[model samples]
Target: MVTAAIGGERPVRDIVPGDHLCLTFADDAEQRPVVTEYLSAGLSRGERVLCFVDRTTPGIVLDWLASTGVDTGAALLGGRLRLVPAADSYLASGRFDAAAMVGTVRREVDASLAEGFSGLRICGEMSWAVRESVGTAELARYEREVDAVFAGRPVSAVCQYDARLFGPDQLEVLDGCHRGSVEPPPLRGHDSLRLVPAGRAGRRRLRVIGTVDDRTHDHFVAALDAVLHRPGDVVLDLSALDFIDVAGLRALANAAARLGGHRRMRLAHPAPVLCEVVRLLGWDRTPGLVLLPEGDVA
Candidate 1:
């Protein structure tokens, strides 16, 4: 039930342990926000993150991350964040050796788990491979072979390729080698679902932002399903939600019915409109549901 950030605030549940994904970007500017948000999600979930920087320097990466509100200094000093130069990591012997690099990453994942971290999240810049003229055949072989590295390990990685540098054929091969690809940026003015880790114990919070309606209830249902699958209590935060349609309300009511008998689901900070609807429908009296007030606004 692990999730990762794909389109900034949007969560992608397809990402899980032992998974490798492909991220194709037109430029660093386009990729910066996605990477920062993705890494921030890992840090918040107490996962160790390793980034291979080739398009930019480690200091620049840290600065960019800080601009996104991540405590870059704290994460780096605490050893939770590891920034490795792309050349040093992918070309340790002054050449691109996929087998060696895979081995190195496997060792790092092991060390991260041994250090008491939940899991490891890795990002590698593949522009260097293209610039270095790492033979297409060799690169393709490397991409295919690397998938085996995550067979049973608690590791998740994204191989970033510059779409402008790679051709259609090569990109197709790369795409096929990955378990999944980073989705396109979500359209503006749409709803977003964020999975926030609740600090108290191993609990989790699903924060719904923007409006949820028939057009977006699928996202809501997916988020709820992800949280409900985990053991223990869950919280749904609607403090930032502006609107919800009847379909969205029905989705929540159905989720409440699926909660474990002993476990409860807390709906916090609902909007004034939602509060009124809940009261009119007597949804507040539903078993396994706790609707909190004070989030209602006139």
Candidate 2:
């Protein structure tokens, strides 16, 4: 059934140029320079610019923004260049935590908005971010809320997304958000899951080369279950996977547990993103863990 709106038209633009500029970048590297260019231009115009993103590649954003070009010197002059949580991140990441991540931005941006200005020019990935309550039901809730940001301001919004990841269901969910033709990002490393032969006989590995969400997790879990029965190791390669919320992370931990009891459970090449989440939640202290060079060892 049609539970949400499809990618029809974007009726609102909440970004304002005088004070703030917000953008949702595609999940890659090259598009980031574009984001920085916008920031530099906004800063040059004495506007406060805040870019929204998840925890996967914080360094990528910072590095690109600080590089020469786009005139960020003015932003530094005015102390306007900042990185704030994209909208609805309050719900995505706890308020306290999100606030911590962008505290500097909050103080400066809030000051700008408070001083004879309009509202906040917030932006973020709007595909599946909802006002949530609890449980996996939250997944559905998030997939539904999409009110335009900077509701009443003279702002420009640019959203970058992956066409390959966009199926009918995902596109339909966008409903009324105006977007451009799909183009590949500069650093296109959004990899997919592939089965690789493991060392030794009868051992194959499952490598998810991109973000693993709840839905993907379910399928992965089932696939792992099927593979566990074979008398060999099924390694999970997480070098490319970026975003995984609490539930998804727990599911992987659980799967590892199961495999350990039966035969062998192994994870390899976890990017800093996965390792940080696992460490933040104290998963490292758990027993039967092998620490990979990248992530937890278990």
Candidate 3:
């Protein structure tokens, strides 16, 4: 039940058991880096790593892992890592069956524990369902039912979706079915700060991770400015943000002022210090800024 919306390799490396994640990638360039980090982390932690592959063969996957510095050959030799074909699992019976897939996952979890591994980590490329014409209902059912297999258990799974292959409506449906998603790449990235687009079409959200201090304040302002131009209110998810200085706070205030009265910039789950600063400066009553407490939906 440890649900989270994560972005980048740093967060992917922190994924734990019982967390089911959805990863919708724009292309292989985005997908491969995250997958590589996931597999490497699981293997390093001594978990049984299972990857269901589509759009790439097992051999290519191994090669890619090796190139990315994963100890693929050793992990495979030790039987701690498995590269499964989508056909052999998701479409084994010539069509997708939600019950059958759930059962398969349950069995794998049991088998992994029996093998004395720390836990089971699984990731699957989900394009096969679309290719095979699996009904959306069936796909959603599989995602929901699979949760039972991981809930409170030593199992973590990530379901990968290709954004290019799935339509917006379909992607939104699939997104709602999972507890969390592996976010798309950052709008801006650096050692000090990473600003990622967490917003969907109608719901504009941005995640600010790491530190936003003097060094990164300009980048933050630039990124935030671009988001402010879009229609609708903006939500800044600061749950993962470690630090933000006065310069960063000024950028937020300026952005809110520019938005006027029509649009707002909502700060969701901001740090205590940030809240205090806003209150002390009377920015909390700023016309275009909204402060949301933790657990309050934007």
Maximum-lDDT candidate: 3
Candidate 1 lDDT tens digits, 1-298:
4543332212334467767777765545446666777777788889999999987678877887788788988999999999999778889989989889878877887789899998888988888987888877887777778777765677788777776677656766666677767543332234354434322112225566777877777777876775575455557778777789877887887788789577777788877778788778877677777777763211
Stretches of candidate 1 off by over 4 Å are: 1-14, 187-298
Instruction: Write down the lDDT that model 1 would get.
Output: 0.71
Two-way TM-score contest, 1 vs 3, winner:
3
Cα lDDT tens digits for candidate 2, 33-142 = 44555545555555555555544244555567667454445554554655544443434454323233344434544576766433233334433232222332333233
Reference-based lDDT, residue 92, model 3: 79
- By lDDT, the candidates rank as 3, 1, 2
Residue 282: error of model 1 in Å?
Answer: 61
- Number of backbone-clashing residue pairs for each candidate, in the order shown: 0, 18, 0
TM-score of 2: 0.36
- Clashing residue pairs in candidate 1 (N, C-alpha, C atoms within 3 angstroms): none
- Comparing 1 and 2 on lDDT, the stronger one: 1
- lDDT at position 248, candidate 3: 82
C-alpha local distance difference test of each model: 0.71, 0.44, 0.79
Off by over 4 Å in 3: 1-10, 187-195, 200-298
